[model samples]
Target: MSERRRRIGDGLAVLAGARPDVLAAAPGARQRFVALGGVLLSTGALAAVSAAFAVGMALGVWWPLAVLVGLGWGAVVVNLDRMLLVGMAHDSSLKRNLVMAVPRVGLALVLGVVVATPLTLQVFSKEIDTEIVAMQAEAADAHRVALESDSRFAGLPDLRERIATQEAVVASGGVADPGLAVVRAGVTEKQAAYDRAVTLQRELDAKAQCELDGTCGTGDAGTGEAYLQARAAADAQTAVVTAARAELDTAVAAVAAAEGRSAALAGSSLDADRAELTRLTAELDRQQAAFDVENEGSGGILLRLEALDRLGGRNMTLAAAQFMLSLLFMCVEVLPVLMKLLLNFSPPTAYDRLVQLRDSGDVELEEMAQESRRTVAQAKEELLVLAERERVDRQKEAILARRRAALAEVAARTEAARAQPEAPAAEEPAEAPRQLWDTGPIRELARSAAVRTVRSVRRRPADRTPTTV
Candidate 1:
């Protein structure tokens, strides 16, 4: 059991290092760390790609660019997943581990959000659809108001009124201008005069035919006189009728010419122009009514976001449900990171404790070896300093000994010279009287002796070595 526990500890440590040896040395550890990491990365990648795809679809991006973006997002998420695990394994102490956990927790939260968004959107699809319909209607009404606000649109009613007035005039057989109405009146009077003239001509022709047929004629005079008189009266009446008919015909022609001009002007004029304006206005209204804002690409999701914000007062039950569902999904996404965090605080099982003890023993042994190496290195450095100090002291002692020997040799020479110089005094030269405390003569003698000794030493041969101390 102890051996097995030791093995588990070694495997865990190795896996934490993410070394290739994990495959050969600890297959179980390899599966636990490497395979699990792969699973996490795959899950994160799928979630990220799905999220990006949904956003692209909502925004109406081209399919190829959307796919490329999804792939990029997936790669980012995979890297984050790997980094999250690495960070989790980096610290052992509670405080330091918690500090390291911050970035991982934030990453997990973002992943959760990415994964949960689509689900939330799917769940609330019906509500979004209804909202879109209402928004479309509102947009249509707004468009209509905007179109009506235009100056040209505002003048449509006036155009319609003018059209109606013109229709009424046309129905009553009136021309476009008041002057054409006067011309029509003249035509009517000329028509009446022409009818009277035609009636007189018809009666004259019938009476003259009866008299010629001998049906009913008074024998007031011979046939010639009656005929002449009848003829003259008939001729005079015909002249009057001809003159009136000619005048009527001329009037009728004048009225016809005026009517023709009026009709021609009406065909090319006001009514046609008004009809065109009416047609154009109606077309504008139709276009305005058909306009729908909610149907625009990506507009639906924006509206959904609005609905979510307003859900609290609008639909409490649905809002609660959505919140709970999102939270549940988010927890699922963060479960692995949470597990790693909890593992840090958990007490080790018996086997794990045994493995930890084994690892601790090894660590202690390694620390002892390092301490021994440091001690040896420090002792070696101290020995080198001691050797250098001893060499300097030896050199200094040799120099002082040489100086002392030179002083002793000079004293010996001075003693010998004093013993051999007694016959050399210049007739006992008189000495100056000295004060009781004075030592002037003794100082003079010492100075002369020192100068003589220095000269003698300079004259000595280099081969004459001074005695050593």
Candidate 2:
């Protein structure tokens, strides 16, 4: 086999053969699938949005797309994040299958109803409105055409000719409108009669409605009966007017009797009517006063409650104090000394140079000062171990917190790193192979890869780089 193929085959064998059962039992497959799915989904999502935006731009309805276009990429990212979380959370055989199936089924159910119902309703409404408007328009057009075909309009030319003849007839004969004169006189007399009848009818109804119903609400039970009586009286008046329609009534005795009786009742009943009116007015005034008193009492109570709340927390003062002594004990700060002794050498939560210096056994003032400036170098192997551990922590945290929080172990290690002194810088340059670590181990492997590349390039140096600028 060629060298490249040999390397690839060896790598594959190493990956495929190592701890196969552990990977099958754990989240290895699901986690790898999640990463793969994220890449595929991201590409598809970007393509979908780009296509949608292009179509929207072509349609000239692009303004409505401002929000969807802007947020689509973020939505894809959120889904990718969700996929990773789920893959980690439910990576086992049955659990992964069950969990994934549920969301798909639920989404199908929701979308089936949500999308279909509104679309169906919209279509039905549009069809109904279109049919209704078309029917109304057709009816209107037919009605307009029938009115245009009326015989009255066809005879308008002859009518216009007679108008001049009528004008001449009026000019030749002075005051020639006997019909108008008779109509005017009849109208005036009928108007007077109508006014008198209306006045009498209103008086009867007002007396019944106001008195029997006790100012409209107190004794309103009799309102229906009184309204029936009013209707009967109106019917009787209508019958009388119908009989007299053609001026055919010549009953002078009946009319005289009605007038005489009406006058007699008005005169003798005046005192009774005045007393009834006085009684009704007094009852109305009493109800009004009672309602006003109740309303006013409730309003006064509300105002008092509002005043109490206003005074409850209207004024307050807040005070705070903090005391810190920088040098309460120069020999040994009182707090630390007491804490170290009482707590069995437990360290304080903050940075403290004095304790570190004391622990380092460099109590001399000059040496302690120099020690404060000293820094230590962490071995390259240690950093490599920590970085590998960090990657593993990140992968686990991605599962537990829905990729939301850093793992607890990662935080602890980061805090440990923060507590330690910084790494010292190098004072001299040196050539070194760089496969495994700067500290050692795989320098020979890096040197081998470098030699192979150099030899390959020298064999065909002209083809090593593209000719284009």
Candidate 3:
């Protein structure tokens, strides 16, 4: 079991290799960093794939691009997690750790949500499918209602009824028409009257002929008169028959007109309307069939998500379950970062102490280096000051040497003038007559002699020159 655990640790380390600084500062730091890093990276990989899958499902045609973006987001998340871990491990103070962790925590939370959503959806797949089916049914019902509400279909029942009424009128002949029925009755009555008038006229004419021939006892003058009367009545009947015939002709013509009007009205516009209705009904059927076909297939992941969203609001128990599940997955994704943060609370390990020691030593060495640089700079400044002073002293010495040379030349000239050896005694006594013994003149002479002696002593320290004129 120990060997197994060791192997697992080594494997994790491979996944999360250590940085050089981390390896150098702490003994066995490589494996620790690797193991922690591996957890982060592995979680990140899961997150990446899950995000790709979820986005691909939601975006449909843009799924490929969404998947790529999700992958990049996952990489960013993993990198942030790694940085957080590093900060947590390195920072010694709680306040510092919290300050450093703010951005990382925010990023981890965002990534955790991104990673958890897909897994949660998978967990509730059955419920989502059921919801999707129900949504499809509702959609189908709405489609049907929309089709039925169309003006063309809506008027179909009225159109059919109107067409049926028109057809019945045509089938029953023109008798159902009020105008045609009235015309037919008028014709029938006029024709019967004309026929009766003809019969009466024929009978009257026969009786008159019998009376004129006197072929019987009853055929007398009275009979003849009666026959005449009968003739007049027959004539009247003839006029009546003529009038009835004209009326009957007019009535027959009216009947023909009525029949023509009825026939013209029966089918002129109704057939066209019915034909249009047939076409529209066919079109509606086709549309409905197409709609049914479209709705038959299973909807995509976006539909499932929409269903889940609805479910979350409607069902509290389900919402709680989903939330808990998502939280669980989020924790899984951020486990590595959490581990590092938790470790910050624990007492420092040997490796932690070592790193701290190494850091302190580095700081001390840096301070020492800075001090050495300062000392060197100070020494250099002092050396420059001393060199400047020496140069100034040398310049003063050069000036003094030139002064001494000038004074020596003056002394040599004075000695030459004094060593001229008493050649002009008369001339000198005449010049010496001008108050040579007066106190002011004597003091001036002494001052000149003292100045000469001082110069002579400096030039040739062996001779003490006498004070002479």
Candidate whose lDDT is highest: 3
Q: Estimated TM-score per prediction?
A: 0.46, 0.17, 0.50
By lDDT rank, best first, the candidates go 3, 1, 2
Which digits, one per residue and each the tens of the lDDT, describe model 3 over residues 387-411? 7556655655665665566556565
lDDT of each: 0.64, 0.41, 0.71
Candidate 1, residues 404-441: lDDT per residue as tens digits?
56557655655655555344445664764344334344
Candidate with better lDDT, 2 vs 3: 3
For this target, which candidate reaches the highest TM-score against the unseen true structure? 3
How well does candidate 1 match the true structure in TM-score terms? Answer: 0.46
Ranking by TM-score: 3, 1, 2
Backbone clashes in candidate 3 total 0
Worst 10 residues of 2 by lDDT: 317-326
Segments in model 3 whose C-alpha atoms lie over 4 Å from true places = 1-25, 28-32, 59-74, 89-103, 143-266, 271-302, 311-320, 359-469
